[model samples]
Target: MLTSIKSFFSNELFNTEKGSTADSSEHQLQLACAALLIEVAVIDQEFDTRELQALITILQTKFNLSAEECETLRTLAQSESEDSTSMYQFTQLVNSACSPEQKFELIKGMWTIAYADGDLDKYEEYIVRKVSELIYVSHSEFIRAKLAARP
Candidate 1:
């Protein structure tokens, strides 16, 4: 288990040049982002239909994934997130591979998922805050993400 987890976080597997896509590194980064989003969706211990929809919508809008791709990514993310010990590894991958704009969009996606059920559970918000910090998102950017996602 740890080996697979370690491989997932291995720098060689995730060292994608920023702005490069359509490669293994991009795929790995996608998986990491998907996992973090799923973590937020389920943090409240009640994964509502609205939250699920929000997750799918966010992935589709942000990554332009087809339904089948979204399903596969979500399934992989769910399994990985269940086995993962911490968010740091995933955020580390994002920080290394993504541009600042990409990171901000992810934080905004997280906030959207957190608010999808119409109330932000304390734990959900905490996860978003922690992820923001881990991904090196500025406090101002974090606040902007939250405000941008506010409905």
Candidate 2:
């Protein structure tokens, strides 16, 4: 009963050069990013359709995932966000693997998911703030992302 990394990426399954089951760094990173957005959207105990669509939008544009691929990842990420206890695993991986600019972009995505319901839920705000800190996004940049993602 483990949440395998490959499951986070997709059920389609991919193999490495040696033919053993494996996920590339690129897929792993994108999964982490997607998982965080899922976490934020579900934080208020409501996985709104708007939030799901916002996540799909972010995943598609940010990771260049096809619409089909984005839906696959979104389904997998939702499972992870619900099954996992903390956001630390995803946030830690993202912080260590991505550049500052990338982290800022992630913050922006989180903000978008948070605001998808047309209002900033307090718990959603709290989750985004914690994620920004976990991913090393500066306070200034975090605030800027919040403002920019307001819709």
Candidate 3:
């Protein structure tokens, strides 16, 4: 039993390490952004299947990662997103690394996650909007993304 438990944790930690190292700093910034989107999805204790699927799709498409790689990164992002209490760490990484255009794209991705389940809750929207502003996306661009992602 002890061995099983240890192995479980070992596997989890290994996945985490592998996920973090699998991408370059730029890709990691994008990964962190995606993780934040998932973080908000679970904020209300309603992690729907659709949202998860949409997140995986976006990661696969946007990052040009293989399905297996996307799954690994999604798993790692979910872990990191849940463990974090503040957005400081993620925002700091993105603000320092992402260009203005990339920041706009990131906002769009966040909106995509929020709309994944075809239901946008208030808190989720608020979190994404706040994150967009923090990441330096213009209000107009943020609104455009929000509208575009709506069903």
| Winning model by TM-score | 2
Comparing 1 and 2 by lDDT, which wins? 1
Better model by TM-score: candidate 1 vs candidate 3 = 1
- Candidate 1 local accuracy as lDDT? 0.86
- Model 2 clash tally? 0
Instruction: Show the lowest summed lDDT stretch of 10 residues, model 3.
Output: 1-10
Assess each prediction's global lDDT (C-alpha) against the native: 0.86, 0.81, 0.73
lDDT (Cα, tens digit) per residue for candidate 2, span 1-151: 2347554344464334422333466677777788898888988999888988899989989977789878877876777777888888798889778998889889999999999988789999999999998877889999999898888
- For model 3, how does the per-residue alpha-carbon lDDT over 90-151 read when each residue is reduced to its tens digit? 88888998788777777787788788878888988888888887888889999988887777
Model 1 — which ten-residue stretch has the worst lDDT? 5-14
Evaluated at residue 129, the lDDT of candidate 3 is: 81
Task: Quote the lDDT for 119 in model 1.
Answer: 92
Candidate 1 Cα outliers beyond 4 Å, as residue runs: 1-22
TM-score of every candidate relative to the true structure = 0.85, 0.87, 0.80
